[model samples]
Target: MLSTTVYKQLPVVSTTTCYQFVRLSSTLAAPQNTPLSHIPKPSKEDHHQDATFVEPKKSPFDVSTRIYTQQGIDGNDDARYLTKPTYPHPVFPTEECESVTVTHREPRTFGDKLSYNGIHIVRKLFDFVTGYADPSPANPKQYVGTRYEMTEGKWMTRCIFLESVAGVPGSVAGFIRHLHSLRMLKRDRAWIETLHDEAYNERMHLLTFIKIGKPSWFTRSIIYMGQGVFTNVFFFLYLLNPRYCHRFVGYLEEEAVRTYTHLLEELKEPGKLPNFQKMKIPTVAAQYWPELHEESSFRDLILRIRADEAKHREVNHTFANLKQKSDRNPFALKVEGLEEPQPNHGLKVMTPTGWERKDMQL
Candidate 1:
């Protein structure tokens, strides 16, 4: 049994050694049978030409390629571009852009004259009120509110008054054009006349109240400043352009005088101002008028009312003639005290009388 076992073990030992020898034989044959180029190749040192890697080509539409920086061109400066378009994206280039000259033409129409004169008067009136005093001695013209209030109210009244009266004469040039669109008075010369009549009515109503001593000091102040400025501007305009200004001032005075006369007739009868006895003087102004202590009478106020209107009427009438004279001369109508008042162009007050025809010596 031992002998048979030993013979079988010999075949097993030989089979294990043969398996190991086959593995060794294959390892030795593997490298020897490979091609030369297939063997491991050595890594060479880097060359400068090899180190450079080509960068990708850039596109024409890149942000840096399309963007540009620009500066502004000033009016006084010479043309930045010699032949650039006059307008941006213009169809054609501009020639003589630097040498081009602009010539101003004089105003030709009546409307233009009216606008210029009206604006000039408005601006001058504004300037006059700049340092003017309110009627009240306590409140000097230091406050801008006083000037603005005076300017606004006077501007409205005078604009209406001038447009209404001046428009009557075709001399005003643009008066017809401006009045053409007003629907209330049929957009005719009548509307301006109505404005004049209304202004006169307002003056009458106010004078009546002042005579009755019913309006407050504050209300009186507003009305007084407004009227005073209106008068000043009216006179100033008359002084500026007499032929046209006379129509407005003369009309205003006539309307105001007529209204005043009518009011006087109405008050002479007993029925007007029913509460004359009951109404009291404003506490402030009554400090000046002692009669308010015993209660006010409407009859007593009438004379004072008429007197004020007459005073303005006289002044306006005198100024109207002055304007007429100035128109003839086309220079300042120098009044005695107001002489040397600087003329704004020819619009200034030069003469003592007013506008006189140039042919007729002032």
Candidate 2:
């Protein structure tokens, strides 16, 4: 049994690992056999009556309210402590984030065309269902207040849904490769770790946005269903052709870059997205992106996120070009004193399409 002092020191909402939660649950569980109203009822007097009360949000989607990790937990349990990130996010300089552009790689090979068209189809279907239509760079008038335009809620909905799905590919890919390595009793050439990192980074993006904007229950349900379907589909396809899967994800990242870049352009119009303009970046966001601070606005946060998408685009596209099972992950390890430019985790040197196999030392 834990002492009173130890119980008092426990956090209200822990960002700890799963086994800790399991252990805590076991400690608190009712004894196995004695039942039939054996436990005593609570006294009229309430312990910790002075705890802060948080009103639950009634609206489906509202940016006016922000969700902190322990908002409601403070009333039920008062101890809340911050947790360090499992995977530290890469530092993105302001200039490097700004350098991110919406670029595309032409689909030349048969596999490339198949991946591009398949992704394009899925995107259009999703966009229509979510009521999101990008404001064309050419059509200036369609930026706001139209049937074709996106509102704060719609944009948040898209972001949450997009990220929920985006995280799946990397995890699925990494799992298959990891199993493959174990079965063959050979090294995976350092691909599994990079893929898992991509998944974690995408999840951070989702969590950061959740603090800034609430999604509707319908949207949440959609995310749940979407993730289930996409996970299984990606899992099976990866087993069949990992290269094609990587190529498909590469094209998907191209769309992600385009999506964020469009959002950045909308931020330029004064008074257009007032909520975004006045909003301070969430603590989770600033915590993940160390370069951000109290003064960072939503636009600044988007810039960092866009830069991440740019990197993923580069990484996945490059993965598609390499010999899947044999080639080492070039981005994971770099050669020193090499005269030629190389692929990197950061934006220092990047290619919109991918690094061709011939360009790499392999």
Candidate 3:
């Protein structure tokens, strides 16, 4: 029995030695037949070379070759070829990656005509208000050159005010949709929930800017007044013409995209503003967005916000299209074909299980 056990253990030990010998031979570039005792140990240079060996690029479809490659072995977790040791970078969609084409649906019915007219008038009103010139005292001359510039502080203040107004439409739309569903005894499983989600998302954006901008009491008061008035007007507009209301929100979002894009450009210009880089991302913004934690630059935050606005623009526009179709034929069913917006670009604001009221309260 003792001899039998020793014989069994000898084979296991021999197998382990053979594995090591093979690895060592590969590392040392030694002949396979070289005696184990005579095999030379690898030098530091040899180890370095082995560590940094670059595999030839193979065709992506060459699965047979790829199966033996480091990328294939690691699958999606492959990091051996990375120049720097770091987590995989998340690729946030830029303006270029997203569709820029705005959908324009011509009026095909009486309801469509009414909705279209309402949208047209409201759009004009929005433009008149937004386009009003309030020249900066510091850059009074900037207003003359087909270009106007505001300091970063001023721009952030503007964002705070705009976000406050921007959040109003989604909330109003959501509340009305909920009420409409309740009154009709039909569940709008699609639009109602989506509108609420949009409202929450826009509110979070408002809160994020509030923390970052830290507006004065006067600014806060202005936001309060604006929200109250805008909320009332939008609520009535939605009740009268839901399709038009959706289109109006879509237009607002398009303007928001342009505003954020402009802000990003300003932030990128060297010496455009002294404190652009100095400002750290707000904690709320960071918590909501994990990518911000890795790269908490203002530019990255702005880009993320812009991406959200772009999605909102698409959603509201699509909603308008659907509403138009519904209005034309009340019995018709509309399907939401738009892709679900990406999850705040992988940011977690509310807990996975439920939203915290305190975290969300404006």
TM-score of each predicted structure versus truth: 0.26, 0.78, 0.55
Q: Which runs in model 3 stand beyond 4 Å of their true positions? A: 1-148, 324-362
Write model 2 residue lDDT over 278-324, tens digit each, in one string: 66776677677889985688899999988888899889999999999
lDDT accuracy of residue 305 in candidate 2: 88
Error of 2 at 199 (Å): 0.2
**Residue 116 alpha-carbon offset, candidate 3, angstroms:** 9.3
- Model 2 clash pairs are none
Worst 10 residues of 1 by lDDT: 64-73
Q: What lDDT does model 2 reach?
A: 0.79
Per-candidate clashes, comma-separated: 25, 0, 0
Q: Write the per-residue lDDT of candidate 1 for residues 26-93, one digit (tens) a residue.
A: 66664454577467443342221122211111343311111001111011123243332221210111
- Give the C-alpha lDDT of model 3: 0.56
Per-residue lDDT of 1-362 in model 3, one digit per residue for the tens? Answer: 99999999999999999999989887777456656747766778655434332232243332111111222212322234433212222345444323332234455567556655765665465434333234454754455444234554456666776777777877788788778778888766456656666676676677666554445555666667777887888888788878667766766776677677666756776777545554555555666654566237667777777766766766665556553323222112332453422223232211121121222211
Residue 309, model 1, lDDT: 31
Best by TM-score: 2
**Model 2 TM-score?**
0.78
